[model samples]
Target: MLVRIVKMSFEPSKIEEFLANFETVKTKIRSFEGCNFLELYRDQNNTNIFFTYSYWNAEEDLENYRHSELFKSVWSKTKPLFNAKPEAWSVDKIASLK
Candidate 1:
């Protein structure tokens, strides 16, 4: 499985817009091909900072999703809300308790 983590920092004024957009698109994203799981997290100390954690069947599946129309649509609405360039990582899970 491939674990994908994306850290996004949004302009404070745009946080609600980002969250609303995520709410509308998250289910579609989670149901996309090869997607095993999806979650959203917010930084306790910094409300504008958020992270997306997801599991995919493989890197190829992830790449496919990234290139899909769903992604482009979601990203177009999301890109302008960011206060900083997002950071992402695709990694193999090394260990997990549950």
Candidate 2:
């Protein structure tokens, strides 16, 4: 499995907007082809910082989603809310307990 993690820091004023947008699209994202799981996390000490942790069948599947119209639409709205450049990582699962 491929593990994808994205770290995003948003402008304080845009956090609610981002959460609302995510609510509207989370299901779509989770159901995308080869997507095994999806989740959003917030930094405990930094409320404006968030992360997305997901599992994909493969890198190709993730790429396909990234290039899809769904991604384009979501990103168009999301990119502007950022206070810092977003960071992402794609890695192989080394082990898991559940």
Candidate 3:
């Protein structure tokens, strides 16, 4: 499995708009082919900061999603809300407790 994490920071005032937009597309994104898991997280100290954690079948599956129209559409709508550039990582599991 491939683990993908994205950290995003939105302008404090734009957070609500971003959340609303995310809610509208979250299901489609979670159900996309090769997506095994999808979730959202927010920083305890910074309500405007968020993270997306997801699992994919492989890197290719991730690439497919990145290139899809869904990504383009969603990203375009979400980009303007950012207070800072987003960061992302794709990692392999090196160890697990359970």
Per-candidate TM equals 0.98, 0.98, 0.96
**lDDT tens per residue, model 3, 17-88:** 999999999999999999999999999999899999999999999999999999999999999999999999
Writing each residue's lDDT as its tens digit, candidate 1 over 4-59 gives 99999999999999999999999999999999999999999999999999999999
Clashes of 1: 0
Best by TM-score: 1
Over 1-83, each residue of candidate 2 has an lDDT whose tens digit, in order, gives 89999999999999999999999999999999999999999999999999999999999999999999999999999999999
Reference-based TM-score, model 3: 0.96
What lDDT is reached at residue 41 by model 3? 100
Q: Which stretches of candidate 1 lie over 4 Å from their true place?
A: none
True-vs-predicted CA distance for residue 78, candidate 1, Å = 0.3
lDDT of 3: 0.96
RMSD to the true structure for each prediction, in A, is 0.5, 0.7, 0.9
As a whole number from 0 to 100, the lDDT of residue 55 in candidate 2 is 97
lDDT of 3 at 70: 98
lDDT score for residue 85 of model 3: 98
Clashing pairs in 1: none
| Residue 23 alpha-carbon offset, candidate 1, angstroms | 0.5
Q: Which 10 successive residues of model 2 have the least lDDT summed?
A: 89-98
